[model samples]
Target: MSRIAVIGAGIAGLTVAAELAAAGHAVTVFEKSRGPGGRCATRRSAAGPFDHGAPGFEAVTAAFAEQVQDWQRAGWVGADAAAGASRLIGVPSMNALAQQLASHLPPGASLRVETHVAAIEHGAPAGWRLRLLDGQLNAGHFDAVAVAVPAEQAAALLAPDASLAEAMRVTRSDPCWTVMAAWSDAWAAPGGSWTAPDPTGVLDRVHRDDARTGRVALDGIASRWVLHATPQWSADHLGAAPAEVIAALTAVLAKSLGVHLAPPVHAAAHCWRYAQVPDARGEPCGWNASLQLGACGDAWHGAGDVAGSRPDGVERAWLSARALARQMALSLTPD
Candidate 1:
């Protein structure tokens, strides 16, 4: 069995770790965050908890459905038919999915969270040595390693290796801004989902009562709402003051709904610097056998082709991870 190190605890990393472990390979996952679910995350407020990262996941493919079924069986996820359309969400929070995937790992399967990988070096034995941000060094012999971070972050990690760095350099990603709020009362929306063909210079998609997960429910009549800003707008206002952005989004939301809604009882803004794949490669996934590094994300595969063109970022990332895992498994024992 190969010793594998999967970088980043996002869906891609989690999926690959599970696949490798299922194949009897020794695998470990390294994440810089405090918990799993890199972008597919949730946040808490006085009102309640809401998924400020990935809104939800869509099960469009047989593979995705099978995984969801497995998750449901494991009690890590729950199925919901929103407006008669099927979707899956984490039981308590979105991160529950990642937590469940991490659960089945072998007793000693290492998951290093809050540990930053500073640099990676190739050893004489063709293994990897990781230099962490805290100056703590961890070296291991691995038959292969997969990098499942954003293209930019991946590029930085592989910079010492010329070819691998070059491959990552070709990959690019964009940013996004998600504005979350809790209203005093449920506001009537025409549909469950609303998209602006031409964003009104502030918001891209407006979702009403979107946080349907059971983890944290909005109290009283107040419900959860979200406004996703266009990538262009997010980029332009990447460093703008948070209060300013919140004010702008609140005003736009009020105008769009044609109601003088109170300033949200709870307001927050999330900036996804590398939110989604802007220019996804035409391949299903990428691997550098020599460097023992692979790169995959929703952007690696055509974003729209993963599930639908509607931009379900988490589901797309999951699809790319699943495909990459299958490929990695095959590579382990080539026929």
Candidate 2:
């Protein structure tokens, strides 16, 4: 079995790790965060669990649809018919999908959370050496390394390679200003969710957490809403402080609803610097023959064909991960 190191614990990383492990290869995943599911995140606070990263996932390919069905049958995810487009979300939280995938890794595979791999370098006989954020190098050498992070993060790690860096640079992502608010009983939700197509508007979509998951009320709030600012608006306000962004977005929310709403019981703003992938080209993944380095993520593929009627970012991540794993597996084995 080949010793492989997969960096980042998002869906892409986990998918690669699981695939390699199932193929009888020893795989170790390194994640910077406390948990998995990079962009497929769910934040829990006094207000409740907020799906601030990706609202949900939709399958475009039949193979991915079958995987989603497996997740559904396994109770790791559930369908949200109200979301339309066969959208599905993690049962307890969006990260549950990543966590579940990690749990099923083979005996030779393992995951390391809160371990930030700062850099990767070729170590001659050792193949690849991982430099951690704490100025220490990982003791184990790997036959291959897969970078399954956002384009910016991947760029930072793979800066030594001009071609890989250029490939990552070409794929651009947009920032997002997200507002999570818990309302009192005074104001009721208008509906499950709403999207604004106006370019000038601050919000692109507003989701009612209570209606989406039926779990927000447990936080002792009447209703909860997640307000996502449009790409242009988020870019315009990207430099603003968190409090300022929250205030402006909250005002925009009420205005967009065309109702005079009271202040929320709880409100907070989160800025996702690499929120959505607007452009992607070349291939589903990038790899170096001599360096044994590769990159893959949602940013590898564009928003998908057919515009608004295509798969979401999470599915792109999955597809990219699968493609990367297939390449890595083929290379590691010989006839």
Candidate 3:
């Protein structure tokens, strides 16, 4: 077994680490945040918790579907009937899914949260070296490295490697501005979830998290909603202050509801810089044999979709990580 380093503790990184560790390889994951879940993010507050990133994702392939079934059995995830019978979300919070996946990693595998890998320094006498954000720390001499971060981030980390660099160039991602709003006891929510298809649009969709998961609750509160701005709108106001974005999106939400809504009891705005990749191309994952460097994420491969219907996010990450692990296995041999 060989020692390997996987960067970013998102679904992709966690999948790669778990699969490699299961194969008897010693693996370690480095994550920038305090916990797992890159875009599968959640924010907790005195008001409650909010899944401001991805609401949920579809399981396309049988491999991913089986994983979801396992999670369901373990109570890590559940079907959101309000969103759709097929739609699945992490219980308690969206990050719970990543946390569960991280927990299932093999005994030899370890996760380092709140650890940022600032740069990758290759060409070491032993193997690749990781330059962490903390100047005093160092990690290196791995058989291989898997960078399972966003395409843009992967590109930056693998810039010294030509093949991986070219592979990430084709993928293009967009921004998203989201608002989490909760109603006061005085204002009753209309109920249910909605997806707006208005041609003259400022918003993309709005979902009732309370209906979907019932994970968030505040005293005297009836319902909560996460409003997502359209890609175009998000791009136009990408740099706008949070208050400005919230105000404009609230107006859009009012227009969608066709009702004069009262002020929210609680409201917050979050910006996702690399939210979605509308157009992306390349292999399911990329690896450089010479440098033993690789990358995998939902942004890799073709339009990360299932039968050209559902946009593959969580499932795609799983598939890409599996592919990378297999490649790593083939390249590394036991001592």
Candidate 4:
């Protein structure tokens, strides 16, 4: 079996690692965060589990849809986020999906969280050496390495591959500002549901976190709201302090709802620097069979879907990861 190391434990990393492991290759996933699911995140606090990142996602492609169905059957996904719609969310929290995927590593496969792989080098005879952020190198000699981080971060790691580096340079990621607030009182929800996509003002999406299915219930009338600002707005205030961001968004929320509303008991703001690409070129994944090195993520996707309805960012990540795994498997002999 080929020994492989996947950097970044986000959806792409986990998906590729899992697929390779299932194909009889020994794979190990490395994540820089305390947990997996970079954007599929949830912050735990006294007033939380706030879905500050990737509130929910949709499964557009048939393959991803089938996979989503499997996740639903396995009790990892539910449609409570968008009532009567196919939009699905991780049960309890968005992070659960990544956690679930990372948790189920069969023999010879493993996951390592909170580990930062600074760089990778290909020596003449020693194979691939993973350099840690702490100046130490991973002891294991992996036959292959996969990079599944955002384009900005992947650019440096993929510099040796001129084509991949150019692709990364072309695929630029934009920023986003998200504010999550919680209250202990009731508020007027839009049409009795708590959501507004492409509504009227500076916001792109406003969702009621607690209103989704599988979330822990509150005793009295309460609300957990998550507000996602438009890409332009987020970029304008990309470096704003969290406190200032929270205050600004809270006011915007009140104005957008056209209600003074109850004061929030908890509120916080998060910035996603690499949130999306305004124009996704839908590039194919990177794989060098002779080198056994590869790269894949939302930045590298080949969405052949119909013109009008292309796959979203989340779906692109899965597609890219799966494509990379399939290519790698084709190069390796099966047991």
Candidate 5:
């Protein structure tokens, strides 16, 4: 069995790690965050936890569809009764899916959270070396390394290898500003809305977390809303103060609801520098067989809707990770 390293504990990395482990490879997954869940992200607070990133996603491909069915059976995810019977979300919280996937790894496969792989380098014997954010080299070598970080971040790592660089040459992702609003009582709009499209042009979509199938308030929080600003707005207000972003978006939200909305007891704003790739492209995953280096994530492939449009955030990550894992597993053998 080969020793593999999969970076980023997001859905894509976790998925690839799980697949490689199932293939009998010894895999170690690295994550920078305190736990797994990268934009399947949740922000924990005294009032409650909010899925500040992608609220949920669709299972378009059959492979992904079957996996979703398995996740459903395992209770890692469930159908979003409000969005439709098809839209799927992680149970309990958006990060729960990552947690479950991380736990499903085989005996030799493992996940290391709070560890950041700052850079990747070539090394003999181990084949690859990981330089961590702490400026320390990882303990050993990895026969193969799969990167599943944001495309923007992956560019730096892939730059050392020309073929890998060319594979993701045209990939781009936009920034986003998301706001979370929590209240002790349900959001009091004219008629309660599970979701609302932006009327003020300052936002993209607004959703109520309480309306989703399996969300219960924590502490004093009984109601929650997630507001996502348009890319243009987010870019325009980039690096703006959180309190300012909160005020501006909430005012727009009040206008959309046509109410003199009382302030949320708990509210905050978060900025995602690389949020979505509306036009993600390239091969299913970037691979350099000669280097045994590869990359995958939402920025890779998988766009097979009737209109040829890609599935939203989470599914794209899953698609690319699964494809890359298959490629790596089949080709990997003991030297």
Candidate 6:
């Protein structure tokens, strides 16, 4: 079997690793974070818990639906038990989905969290060697490698290789600020997801947790809201202090909602510098065989501009991982 190294334990990386392992190939995932879930993560606070990253996922296409079904069957995700239901979220937190995807990894399949890949070198005879940022060298002759990191980070890591660097350079992503609030009182909206019609609006989308169906807790005593800022707005103010950004966005959210509410009881802001896609070419996934590098993300899929655009993020990552796994499977086959 071929040894494969999947970089970035996000949905894309995890999906690829699972597929490759199921195909009998040895797979290893390296993640820079303390845990999996990447952009689709949840953060816990003294006030409550909020899915600060991806608020929820929608299964549009058959492929995405199948994936969701599998996750649900595996008990990784659950349908929200709220009013007008049309989405799914991870139980307890978003990371549960990633954790479940990784559950069935073969004995040879492994994941290394908090390990940052410093650089990758392709040896003519020895195959691919991945160097960790901590200077701990782990050598393996991988038949293939899939990179699921943001385009900019991927570009930096693959800089030593000209062709791979160029491929990454062409991939770009946008940034945004996610403001999370846990309120003491409940709030109602027309739908589970709301987009401000104002072009110059500070908030792009707002999700009310209590309004979602099948939600674990909607005690009305605690309400969670996520405010996603426009990419341009986030970019312009990314360097500002976190508290200041949160306060400003909280104000904008209050005014936009036509409610003169005070700053949320608990408010926090997270900045995703590479949050969305950037008008890239090709399909939802791309691979460079010569460089043994693959790229994927929502940007590669669509602009993720639809009502249920978050699923595209997982879809793009899975597509890229699947492409690489198939290639590795072929290459690792006995002659």
In order of listing, the candidates' clash counts read 0, 0, 0, 0, 0, 7
- Model 3 / residue 247 / CA error / Å: 0.3
Error of 5 at 119 (Å): 0.9
Q: Name the lDDT of candidate 4.
A: 0.81
User: CA lDDT of each candidate?
Assistant: 0.72, 0.80, 0.81, 0.81, 0.82, 0.71
RMSD values for the candidates in order, in angstroms, are 3.2, 2.5, 2.1, 2.1, 2.2, 3.6
Pairs that collide in candidate 2 are none
- How far off is model 2, as Cα RMSD? 2.5
Candidate 5 lDDT score relative to the true structure: 0.82
Cα-lDDT of candidate 1: 0.72
Which model, 1 or 4, shows the larger lDDT? 4
Better of 5 and 6 by lDDT: 5
Q: Report the lDDT tens digits of candidate 1 across residue range 1-335.
A: 77787888888788778777777778889899998888878787777776776666777666667877878887787764442347677777777788767776664356889878877767767677777898877766667777788878888887756765676678776788888888777666554456754446778876554445465564563677777888888999999887888888878877877778777788898898988776666666776665666766665662335443433456656767766777777767422
- Cα displacement (Å) at residue 12, model 3: 0.4
TM-score of each: 0.87, 0.93, 0.93, 0.93, 0.93, 0.87
Positional deviation of residue 94's Cα in model 2 after best superposition, in angstroms: 1.3
- Per residue, candidate 5 scores C-alpha lDDT tens digits across 1-335 of 89898989999999888888888888999999899989898888766778889888887777788889999999989988777788788898889999888887777789988898988889776588899998999987888899999888888778768767665666778898999998776556632224545655687877777667677757677678888888889999997999999998888888877667678898999999999987777457777777888898998774334356556678889888988888887789733
Which regions of candidate 3 are displaced past 4 Å?
134-137, 186-190, 302-311
Q: How close is candidate 5 to the true structure, as a TM-score?
A: 0.93
Model 3 scores worst on lDDT over the 10 consecutive residues at 302-311
- Which portions of model 6 miss their true places by more than 4 Å? 80-86, 139-141, 186-191, 197-199, 213-221, 278-280, 302-311
- By summed lDDT, the worst window of 10 consecutive residues in model 2 runs over 302-311
lDDT of 6 by residue, 301-324 (tens): 522334444445656666556655
Tell me which residue pairs clash in candidate 4: none
Candidate 6 residue 308 Cα shift, in angstroms, is 16
For lDDT, the strongest prediction is: 5
